[model samples]
Target: MTETITRTTGSADVRGLSRWTAAVILPIGPAAVALLRYFLPYDTVDDSSTMTSKVMAEPGRMSLVLWLGFIALLTLVPAAYSVGRMTRRRAPLLTAIAMFLVVPGYLALPWLAGTDQLLWSGTEAGLDANTITRLAETPHPTVAVAGVFFVLGHVLGTILLGMAMWRSKVVARWAAVAVIVSQPIHFVAAVIIPNHTLDLIGWGLQAVGFAVVGWAILRLRNDDWDLPAVA
Candidate 1:
């Protein structure tokens, strides 16, 4: 009977992880690809396309992608809290809230991506003189919406991630601190530099988060935190 229980629990762990992989981890890479398309180093920002005008042109659905991509970060930091909790006695509510935020945010991501395609297509095709002026006259409403949400999700997520570090102590206290501190470092940069390097940060951070989350999850699997099955 003990052996049977162990086997059953093991099976459950595998299943739970599989679901997590689909819902959270798997989407990170693809979503990043979708987001970086417009923001990368050499990405086109037409001389003709002013800050406001450029954003207004297409605005079809890229925000969805960016949002989803940002959602990965949202999921990532909380995931750290979850990891830290593995070794801690106190439960981490921040991580749980972060996890819960993932679904709605992710669901909204693809639509934003679509909007991007539409907006870009308009820009690449070139707008009429009047259209260009209109684009620049005031901030495009959609751009503001996307930008605010993107920043909010990420900045908050990083804080949550840092807190997880404080809680988990897995990557060592200093390293965890660095992870959390990186957010503020980058944020300061946004003000100092020509623009936010959020895309770059997103790309770079994804690889790191992937490795960290994978390691933590592996450890969880070994320990059978949920006690799914005995291995």
Candidate 2:
């Protein structure tokens, strides 16, 4: 009986730790990604050749930015999962749908990162900007599909998740609204206007939104965060 109790306690402890860790990293991922966008060395023109030239000009800084983005992508997975878990009880279907979109969307990071890596390699090989741009622009069917998934998944999924959180009342209404509006603003700032400052603000809203969620999670009892193991 003692052994059984100990085993159950250990399981509960592990579960609690997992949820707490997720809570801690939730805000961090979005914040890091937001900073990555703000500090990106690429030009605002959306021209591959211009971007390549800028990256080549500051290879070290660009590399660091890329790595920061990679790490942010890694962290976002758990952050999404934790949000889903928090809102699931009240909005199970929405959480499910959001996770379905978000998981693949964030997972497609490698496909996006491949372009940056390709540019870096071309620069290192002393290729001309136009040549590198040509290679980067060469479309692959698989990459094209992944790009679609990445865009739809992150943008739509985040909005859905925010709606779920709002319905569930897991986070403050303002925070939920922030999450819902963040991606659309980011899209406009990144694509429509291409203003890095606006881009930062867009993603910064998401970071703030998630930060509030993290605080809510931190306030929960371990049993509430993750159910205690049955004995």
Worst 10 residues of 1 by lDDT: 40-49
Count the clashes in each prediction. Answer: 28, 0
**TM-score per candidate, in order?**
0.55, 0.90
Give per-residue CA lDDT, model 2, range 176-227, as digits (tens).
Answer: 9999998898888777888778888888898898888888888888878876
Q: Give the lDDT of residue 141 in candidate 1.
A: 70
User: Which regions of candidate 1 deviate over 4 angstroms?
Assistant: 1-49, 52-91, 97-115, 124-126, 129-147, 195-210, 222-231
| CA displacement after TM-score superposition, residue 197 of candidate 2 (Å) | 0.9
- Model 2 misplacement above 4 A: 1-12, 43-45
Q: What lDDT is reached at residue 92 by model 1? A: 64
C-alpha local distance difference test of each model: 0.47, 0.85
Tell me the deviation in Å of residue 198 in model 1. Answer: 8.7
CA shift at 165, candidate 1, in angstroms? 2.5
